[model samples]
Target: MDRSAEFGRWKAQSLSKADLSRKGSVDEDAVEVVELLNSREEFFTTSSCAGRILLLDGSTEGSGVQKQHCCWLLVTHKPCARDDVMAALKGATSEAVLKFEPFILHVQCRTLQDAQTLHSVAIDSGFRNSGITVGKRGKTMLAVRSTHGLEVPLTHKGKLMVTEEYIEFLLTIANQKMEENKRRIGRFYNYLQHALKRETISNSHSKIKERNNPLCTHKNRRSQGKAQGPSTTEDNGRELEDGDGLEISAALFLGDD
Candidate 1:
């Protein structure tokens, strides 16, 4: 049989007995069976539910479903084995629902240090800190902190004056960032330690080699003059000598500093 026909047959056998009632009493063993069916590659398709009844039994997939709903029934009394069953059901045919799960983090901070820590956390979680700005005006200098493209208005006391939902979203984003920061810091510290150890070993070997070499002296050498004519004198009566002990004529020029 062709691939499509084979897939349809497999889906038919798997979901043949699925119940569509939200309150139907599912057999305990059927839960595992349903979970397996949902996890199969063919289960996330229009063909999979063609004859099967949805748990909500609505005319359409998302008619009565709430936004951001979780654990709602897709197939009646069927086990939801997939990680994102609701999302899969919404976009089973179009493949768009899978992309709707947004990246989120949770952040918490009251002081600059806390803010910095949160920022680091964001970085560790594979996100940029971006920045923080004043969320709302208060009587004092305190204001609500906004980060990661989320804005939470502040009250007169500098506390967040937004809905609980908004605050939760912000915190979630911050937390993800914090976790990312931790991983990055760990990797950086490991690299730094390895570099320091390598440098220390190289320096130690160089020092040992220098100590063993007798010609590696620390004193500075003085220039020797060669044999020549009589030495010349400057205005200060200081004698100037040549390379071979001969006196040399010289002049000095000074500029104001």
Candidate 2:
């Protein structure tokens, strides 16, 4: 099948599936980004988390716990409180861990160039670990992530190992990470609005109009063929837009503080 038809079919199938995540909805912190991506022909969010402060109960085997087998005792997407963690710890029967997970997102792009454009945006927004992957079957995906995460064992054999003072200290650090995570998400959103949105618009019928009539009108005092250079071409034998979007991509890989 052609790229547009294939992309349309894949997107339809993917979005039609159920949400298997525990919460069954996008995390509040990531809601804006998810919406923005899905609105574009070039992108869609496959999975995402705004970041979380979590407390879990699980087996303490070999002094470590496996998250897949753990029971979530307390989970908060916002900055957490000491009382909440303390209360959750009271329920641990085996090992309990306190964790601060940084914001993470997986986006499927229509093409490798789309993934790369997104990768650069993620990096500029402080998600330095962001990268792109191209599947064997030709699916292109981008993962936006960072290294700012924390995991600490708070209980062993159902006994609290750290003093209240230490737990308080951990809370401070975790909260700080959550705050930074939010900032990064904000930066990412702003950057996408500037860069991705432009590219998304170019993929519209304007791309066809521009292709058929690259030098028709004169606006801004002397420009006709310049219109041809406005889109960032995406697919082959397939679909999508040109010049300014291309200029933006070339001049950038840019964003906020």
Candidate 3:
């Protein structure tokens, strides 16, 4: 099937399927972004997580432990309370680890351009680890993610490996990551809305301008902005950088996957 047809079929079937994530449905923090993307004709979300602070076991034994094999001692999308986490840790049968996983989203785009556009929004919004993967089956997926995650072993073989003071210290870091994750998600959603609207408005404006004045050319349009160009992008030749004010290398490809 053609890419568009394939994407359409996949989207329809996927959206109709039951929520398969561990939490059953989309997290409250991620619902808006997922709905926003699904509302767009060019994109649909496959899966998403708002971000979470996790306490799990069975993962400390292996280098790449699958989540399914691990026992989720505790999982919270919001900042975890010390008492709640301490209570959850009591059920730990083996090693227990505390972790903070940042927000992640998987979006299927109708075209490569759509994926790239979404990728830019993610990168600019501080999900620096975001990436695009084009499958052999003509599926273009963009994963919005970041590397600001934390994992620390709190217990070993059902025995406390660290002092309560240390656990509290760890929670402080994890909670900070959770707060930062919230900020990034907010930025991503806000920027994505603006970007999509800008694209549509720019396209419509170009068509209307051409239809209204067929003789108007690119040079004519360029001269029209010359008077107020100081505040426009035309004067920010060297000021443009990554959204986070970091020096983004031109050669940097937005992919860590």
Candidate 4:
């Protein structure tokens, strides 16, 4: 199987899947970063979210939080306003929790090397949870994530646990987290762009070296052909002229048959 061609096919399919999602990220900067990654040849976005602030009602179970029965009172990809959050809290029936999740992005890469490079960039940009994983079809994928998140209980059994002042305080912190997420996304974009530019430069230099070295160029091949004498071709039970137009392994007979 052709790995490069297979990667191209997978990338096309993933891009189509991304387009099918009608919900766009509210964070314009995050959207811009997604577009930048998609524009590169070695990477494609599989799934992405700019991050969000959520008001949810959930209860604790034995060891884990029972979020299956949780209901979302409010959700916004951007920072939530004090009034908007307060309004959502007024009608809470159960324990309500406020959450601030950082930006998360899943990228399908063409090679393990590309995946590794992206993983490193994500980590360096403060996305500590960033890592690489093999996909179902043996493709390498990178998960970009951060450790910056907030989950605080706001109310218990329909009763406000804290005053409005406390809620406002949490909102301020959530907004700060949102700004940090944006900055990380921006840093990731810059680093990835630099890496791409370096790759392009390295490739260009290699091509120039090959042409100048006279060992891998067309001129070199012609010289080798001359040193080895004219090529030969064979037909069905017949010996053809050396100049006959025939492909003998990798050798090319340059004239008409």
Candidate 5:
């Protein structure tokens, strides 16, 4: 199949699934990126999160060791307030933790080549931990992610380890991390768009070059002659049967298997 036809088939497959990022509870900052990816023929966003700050109640092991139960006390996609964090900490019976997670985005690609293109762009845009994997039924999935995260223990055995002033300081740091995460998201979108624009321009130049070059024309004519079943060499090259030449040219142009 030709590139256009293959792309059309892939697009139809992608449009069959609902984009979950459209739900109301999804992070507001990530909505635009999801929409951009869906608009492209090569990509479809499956699932995504815009990161969050959370309070957790878990247990502490020996020095510098703790096993979190992944329980959340309070979760916010945006920056949380000092009053909010303090209020959540008051009722902590075990160990308390304040965590900040960076943004994450998952995209399904039409091919492995497409997935690699996106992976390269993600890394250039500061998503250092981004990766590609083949999921169910051989679908190529691209995960856009960053390593900006924080996990700090706030209390132990129902007692506060840090002072109120220190809690405020930690909240300041978490807010800074939230801002950095948003910046990285913006970078990802900008870089991807720029790369796509370059590819389009490059493809245009390739087509123009292919049309103007005489060697390519001669080579195509030779292939057509062979398809026509033993044609004699002519002044330009070799004359080919009418229908056979067109068929041969199309197959060669499309790289059909």
Candidate 6:
């Protein structure tokens, strides 16, 4: 069968019972899944487990270790540069940012304690923790906070392992934020186009002014020349009626003309 069909069948098989109960103790399959979920560097690596356990132990001894595979959905209130996000993740010890492309990042963790630590780091780094959800296919001791009206899966496990759910939720939010970013970019390009057009128009106007001003000035000089030439000659000719002033005027005027 096709992969889609196979996946559908698998999902259907998995849903046969909301809770898969092991014969008695924790199932090997469940433990394997938990281990795989936590093994990723983005999640609580083996090294981080000790520190995480310490923190959880401090909270309560019985606050038993519940393995959770969660994805955290974070939204930046402002557009964050990709490098800035990577730098923040790198500086963080508890949570490692997995994928930093543009404004979105993906992270994974083994336990809720680890998940919470990562969430705190993301918040401190200027990301808004938008939402979280968890899901599981079998019985486990994991508990989830599902009071936010999100449709979450419940399993025989205490609460659905929220790690996977959080990851899925973060992906959805990231896709939505990406769409929003595309729209904003489109708007910005449009604004740039309009501004460029306005600048072009202004430059064209300036060029036109620059080109025409000299022509206008030339025309004014020509007109003045035509208007004042003969009149001055006529005035000069009739000006000799005065006397000694006329002699000096005649010499100066003739020389100037």
Model 6, 1-257: lDDT tens digits are 75345434543453344443223222222233234334333231111100000001011123448733333323232334434433333233232333322222233333343344333332322234222234363111122111111122222222223354464554455445544434432332243233334334544555565576755453454333233222221234444554212111010011100
Single out the weakest 10-residue window by summed lDDT for candidate 5: 248-257
Q: State each model's CA lDDT, in order.
A: 0.31, 0.78, 0.78, 0.74, 0.72, 0.31
Clashes of each: 29, 10, 0, 0, 0, 11
lDDT (10s digit) by residue, model 2, range 1-257: 98867877888788889989999999988999999889888788889999999998887555445334679899999877788888888899888999899999999998776776687678767787777788988888899988789999989989999998899999999999999999999998988787665554544545566668886342421122224234443434422453212212222434564
- The TM-score between candidate 1 and the true structure equals 0.25
Considering summed lDDT, which 10 consecutive residues are worst modelled in model 6? 48-57
Candidate 1 lDDT by residue in tens digits, 1-257: 76446545645663565555444433332233234324434332111110121222112236655643333234322212233333334433321111111122222222332233233322322333323333342111111111223222222222223444543454455345434333443432343233334334544655575677756432211011111112233244544553222122311111111
Off by over 4 Å in 6: 1-94, 98-162, 214-257
Q: Candidate 5: lDDT of 212?
A: 81
TM-score of each: 0.25, 0.78, 0.78, 0.76, 0.69, 0.25
**Residue-by-residue lDDT tens digits, candidate 5, 47-89:** 7888889898877655555554546678888888889988988
The model with the greater lDDT, 4 or 6, is 4
Candidate 1 stretches greater than 4 Å from native: 1-153, 158-160, 214-257
Writing each residue's lDDT as its tens digit, candidate 3 over 1-257 gives: 77677788899999999998877999998998999999988999999999999998874445554444678888899887788888998998788888899999999999876776687778767788888899987789999989899978888888878877888888888898888888888878887886677556555666677789999786654334222212211223455555434232111222221
How high a TM-score does candidate 4 get?
A: 0.76
What are the per-model C-alpha RMSD values against the true structure? 30.9, 8.8, 7.0, 18.1, 15.5, 34.4
How well does candidate 4 score on lDDT at residue 203? 54
Best by TM-score: 3
Report how far off residue 145 is in candidate 3 (Å): 0.8
Candidate 4 segments whose C-alpha is farther than 4 A from its true place: 18-27, 62-67, 209-257
Q: With candidate 2 superimposed using the best TM-score fit, by how many Å does residue 227's alpha carbon deviate from the native?
A: 15
